[model samples]
Target: MAKVQVLGTGCAKCGYLLKNAQVAANERQAGDVVEKLDDMLQVHEFNPSALPALAIDGKVVTVGTLPSPSEIRQLIEQSQEVEE
Candidate 1:
């Protein structure tokens, strides 16, 4: 399973991104692998210049803006591939 992490400050966009990430993961059958990080300390660990960053397997994949569900799905798929 891929480890999908959403890093944000618990704002609207952050929440949306987390939901989108969840939906994307579910679409890819990775729903149970998604995690959200709203704590400033943990979120800053990713060093995102913007809110709502998406990290897969501890590596930041998207940052600064919200990505579409399909886009996020693709990212998750790619991460899975890399894992294999």
Candidate 2:
């Protein structure tokens, strides 16, 4: 299964992003595990100052904004393609 990580400080925006990401993954039928990281140190480790970052399979895919359902689906597809 793919591993998805959302990095943020547990703010509203962060929560929204995480929810959106989860929706996207489900829509795409992606068999991935989604996790939320609210620690600053973890967010920093992702090398993004922005509050809401999306990572798929250990690679950062998005930051600073909540992706739409279509966008999230695209990301999931791309990640799956890369894995194959």
Candidate 3:
């Protein structure tokens, strides 16, 4: 299974991003582990310019914007394929 990490500061946007990511993962049947990191330090560990970032298996994929459900689903699908 792939590891999905949401890096944010616990803001409304951050929560929305996490929710969208979960929905996408479920829709895609990604079967990934989703983790939320609210600490900047931890987020920076993965992405130096972290701000509402999404990491799949420790690689930064999305940052800055809260992606739409469809976009997130595509991302999850791509990540799942890469894992396999």
Candidate 4:
């Protein structure tokens, strides 16, 4: 399963991204797990250069911008490809 991690401080952008991730996962129906990292310490540990960054299975995919659900689904597919 792909692990989608949204790193942010629970701001609007962050929340939007989190929702998008969930939407993407649901649409894909691939058992992807979407999670949010709001704690500064946890998010800082991820070491994202920008807020609202996205990571798939622990690999950073995008930062500072929200991608569409389709795009996010594609990302999850790519991550699963790597795993396989």
Candidate 5:
């Protein structure tokens, strides 16, 4: 499993990112790997730089702008590769 995390407040973009991350993980057959960290303070604890960030296995991958589903899928695949 990839253990993907979507960090952000309960905003539209955040929700979309969470949904897309889940879809990407599903496409890659990573099981239920996507999680959302909607609490701002908790998000800061992970990466105080920006909201709407993406993380895999507790490591921040991307921040700010939303990534496409294809991109998210690629990211998941890459994380799995790193773990192996």
Candidate 6:
């Protein structure tokens, strides 16, 4: 299973990203753990200041912007491929 972490506080964009992350994971049958991480400690690893970011496993993929659903799928695919 992939660990999909959406790093952000309780912002609307954060919520939206969390929702879509779950959806994308479901569509891919990736068994991903899609979650919102409000902890600043983890958030700072990606960007000390970016409100919303997406991470696959422990690696940050995007910062400060929402990714298209297709882009999310591609990230998942790439992550899984690396695991294989």
lDDT of each: 0.86, 0.82, 0.82, 0.92, 0.85, 0.85
Instruction: Please give, for residues 1-84, the per-residue lDDT of candidate 3 as tens digits.
Output: 677788988988889999988887777674767889998778878854748888888888998888987897778778778878
lDDT of 5 by residue, 23-71 (tens): 8887887584788998877788886477789998889999987998889
Cα lDDT tens digits for candidate 4, 1-84: 789999998899999999999999999887889999998998887788998999998888999999989999998998888888
Better of 3 and 6 by lDDT: 6
TM-scores for all predictions: 0.90, 0.87, 0.85, 0.95, 0.90, 0.86
TM-score of 1: 0.90
Highest TM-score model number: 4
TM-score of 5: 0.90
Q: Write the per-residue lDDT of candidate 2 for residues 15-63, one digit (tens) a residue.
A: 8888887887787674767889988877788887576889888888988
Candidate 1, overall lDDT? 0.86
lDDT of 2 at 38: 87
Instruction: Tell me how far the alpha carbon of residue 11 in candidate 3 is from the true structure, in angstroms, after superposition.
Output: 0.7
- Once fitted onto the true fold, the runs of candidate 3 whose alpha carbons sit more than 4 angstroms away are none
Encode model 6's per-residue lDDT on 1-84: one tens digit a residue. Answer: 889999998799999888889888888885778888998876877773567889998888888888877788899889889889
Give the clashing residue pairs of candidate 3, or none: none
Q: Which digits, one per residue and each the tens of the lDDT, describe model 1 over residues 6-31?
A: 99878899889988888888888744
- Badly placed stretches (over 4 Å) of model 2 are none
Where model 6 places Cα greater than 4 Å from the true spot, the runs are 47-49
Clashing pairs in 4: none
- Per-residue lDDT of 42 in model 1: 95
Candidate 2 achieves a global lDDT of 0.82
Those runs of model 1 whose alpha carbons end farther than 4 Å from true positions after fitting are none
What candidate 4 gets wrong by more than 4 Å, as runs, is none
